[model samples]
Structure formats: structure tokens, C-alpha cells
Target: MNTILKQFLLVSSIYLFTPTVDAYSLNDSLTKGTAALSSATQVKGEAQQLVGQLQSQLGVSQAQAVGGTGAMLQLAKNQLGANTMSTLSGNATGLSSLLGGSSGLSKNLLSNISSMSGVQSAFSALGMDPAMIQQFLPIVLGFFGEQGVGSTLLGQLQSLWTPAK
Candidate 1:
């Protein structure tokens, strides 16, 4: 009976004294979540700066800016292909986010805008005239130029966005 009592006490003490192990603690989870949110905000801020420029310069709404810019980028991606677009995105911070991380509305609006006509349709959907594509070209090109995109890539984007005579 004494041995049984000793074993019981030992087991109880072991359980009571043992530290709990968690893969992710509440504090750790919160820290990681905060870090992720901060990173996302930075990316969004970069995108917002570009969008704001488009809106203010063109007198368009936020949706128009995002959709128009996204349409142009999608068209570029389609024309330049993924590898070249990757190079462009590498040179320009937040370009990838504009391409893939904008709001769901812009994504849905611009996802199919891989061709010139699609771009026009996207502009029409946003209540902007198709002629606005020309207006958006220089601003986007200038934005890329300011972002340190090389002249070669800028030339390619310009040619892609420009209509042939």
C-alpha cells in the first residue's frame, strides 16, 4: 500500500510539475501576425502611392486607378511573358502586389485583360473611355522609370503599351 501511494504521488507530481509544450504560443502567434500585417501594409502603401498618383493625375476614382493600372500590367504580362514580367517586377517594388495582390474587385476586373481589347473593356467597365489607355501609358511608364526600372524594360513596356500606326 505504501509503494502504491508513493507511485501515485510520483505520477501526480510529475504531471503537475511538467511544463506544457505548445508549437505556437499566443504571444508568438500575435507577434508573427503583427509582423505579417506590417509587411502587408508596406506593400499596400507602395501600391496605394501609385494608385493615388493615377487617381489624382487623371481625376479618376480609386477603382478606376486600380483597374486601369491592373489592366495595363496584365496586358504587359501577357505580352512580355512571365519571365520578363518577373524581371520588371524585380526592378519595381510592389509591382507584383499590384499585379497579384490588389483588391478582389480589381483582380476580377483585370484578370481577363490580357489583350488590348480586354484592356479597353476593363476601362469601359470602370466607366472610363478606352482613350484613357494612352493617358495612363506615360504615367505608368514614368512610375516605372522612377522606381529604377531600366531603360531597356521601360522601352519594351512603352512599345507594348503604344499603339502602332
Candidate 2:
């Protein structure tokens, strides 16, 4: 009876003292989840600021602002190539999110807009006049300028966006 009691005590102590693997893994997962949520929130806030600006300045709806900005960014991506667009996106917060698949428009739709005419059509599809693209351009350029985009890149964007006479 004495030996059995000692063995039971030793087993109980071992179980009590041993650290749980699940606890450490759960903590790590929670930390990662929190960081990811924070990053997503920051991106959403930055995009919201731009969307708010577009809505107030252009008198457009939230969907219009997102779709228009997405259209323009999609055009820039098509014209500038992935590396250049990556640089541009790095300079501007939430720029990538605007062009991301989750932005109001679908990935397939954004990928389809490779030119100014395509942008205009996208604008039209968003219930905005195609000419509104002109208004959106200046505001978007100004926003990029404020975000510290280089003049050379800005010039390239301007040239790409400007309608030919």
C-alpha cells in the first residue's frame, strides 16, 4: 500500500509539473492573430482616409471611390509593370490593398482594365460618368504626391493617365 501511494504521488506530480504543449502553441497563435489583425486594421484605416477624400471631393459613393481608385491603380499596374508598381505601392500606404482582390471590385475585373478606355468603362460600370475619370486623376495624383511618391514616377503616371488631344 505504501509503494502504490508513492507511485501515485509521483505520477500526479509529473502531470502537474509538466508544461502543456497546447498552451504554448495557443499563445503563439494568438500573438500572430493579433499582429495580423492590427496590420489589416491599419491598411483599412489608410484606405478609408483615401476613400473619404474621394467621396467628399468628388461627391461619389464609397463604392464609386473604391472602384475608381482600383481602376486607376489597375491601369498603373498594367502600364508600369509589377516592380514599378511595387515601388509605388511601397511609397503609398494601402495602395496595394486598393489593387488587391478584396477591394470592392473582383480580381478578374481589375485585371481586365489595362488601358484608359478600360478605366472609363469601369467608371461607367460603377455608375459614374466616364469623364469623372478626369476629376479622379488629379485627386489621386495629389494623394500620391502627399504620400511622397517621386516626381519621375508621378510624371510617368501623369503621362499614362492624361488623355491625348
Candidate 3:
């Protein structure tokens, strides 16, 4: 009975004293998540500024700028791989609302816009002038360049800007 009691006490002490193994890993994950979210917020701010630039430059309504910009971003997203798209989308807060809010309009607008001509078509379909498409492409690409998008993705986006014939 004495030996059994001693063994039980030792086992209980060991169990009680064991350190929590998950605490460090969980904290690390949280730190990474917070950093990622912070980056997304910064990118979102830059995107909003670009939208403002579009509105002011084109004399279009806010809705037009946001929607058009969203469509353009969707075009780029379509060209990227799944992981890149996820990172891009996750980092932009304005994307969700500008993409037409879960309705089919956004998807439909993006469906036809696979290239430069498609960009003009999509904008024209949205009631924007075809002439303005060239102007908007540089603005969008310039904004992304400022935001530090890599050459690969930026190049992909730039390819969508064939000037009006």
C-alpha cells in the first residue's frame, strides 16, 4: 500500500508539472495572423486611394470607380494561381464590396474581361467610355506598382492593357 501510494503521488506530480506544449506554437500562429491582417489593411488603404483617384480623374461616380476597379482586379485574380489569388484577395478589404456583393453581376462583369479587349468590353458594358479604358489601366497598374506587387503579377496585369486601336 505504501509503494502504491508513492507511485501514485509521483505520477500526479509529473502530470501536474508538465509544461503546456501548445502555448508557444499557438502564440506564434497568432503573431503571424496579426501581421498578415496588418498588411491587408495597408493594401486596402492604397486601393481606396486609387479608387478616389479614378473618381476624381474620370469625373465618374464613386460606384463606377469602385465597380470598375473591382472588375479589373478580378481580371488579374483570374490570371493568378489559387494561392496568389487568395493572398491578393485576402489582403484587400475593399474587394468584397466592390465585387458586387455575392450577386451575379460581378461574376458576369468579370466573365468577359479576360484581356485588353475584354477590359474595354467590360467597361463599356458598365457604361464607361471605351476611351477611358487606356487611361484607367495605367492608373491601376501604377497603384499596384506602388503597392510593391512583384514583377510577375504586375506583368500579368500590364498585359491586359492593349491601347485602343
Clashing pairs in 2: none
What TM-score, over all chains together, does every model reach? 0.66, 0.69, 0.58
| RMSD to truth, every model | 16.9, 16.8, 18.8
Deviation from native of the Cα of residue 139 in model 1, angstroms: 0.7
Predicted structure with the largest TM-score when compared to the true one: 2
lDDT of 1 by residue, 1-165 (tens): 699999999999998886666634744553443233223332354567788788899998776676677778888888788887777677665766665474454344445666788878667766789899899998888887887888998999888877666
Cα TM-score of candidate 3: 0.58
Candidate 1 residue 113 Cα shift, in angstroms, is: 2.4
Candidate 1 structure lDDT: 0.70
> Regarding lDDT, does 1 or 3 come out ahead?
1
Instruction: Summarize candidate 2's per-residue lDDT along 1-165 as a digit string, tens digits.
Output: 699999999999999997799987866664443233223322354667787889999899776787778778889889888876777667666766666445332555578778899888777766789889889888888888888889998899888887676
Point out the worst 10-residue segment of candidate 3 by lDDT.
Answer: 34-43
lDDT of 3 by residue, 1-165 (tens): 699999999999998887667975765654443233222222244467787888888787565576567656666665554565555555444555454445454455454555666656556645678677667888877776666667777776677555535
Q: After aligning candidate 2 to the native by TM-score, how far in Å is the CA of 84 from where it should be?
A: 2.4
Candidate 3 lDDT for residue 67: 56
- Model 2, residue 82: distance off in Å is 1.0
The candidates, ranked best first by lDDT, are: 2, 1, 3
Model 2, which residues run further than 4 Å from truth? 1-45, 103-105
User: Number of backbone collisions per candidate, in order?
Assistant: 0, 0, 0
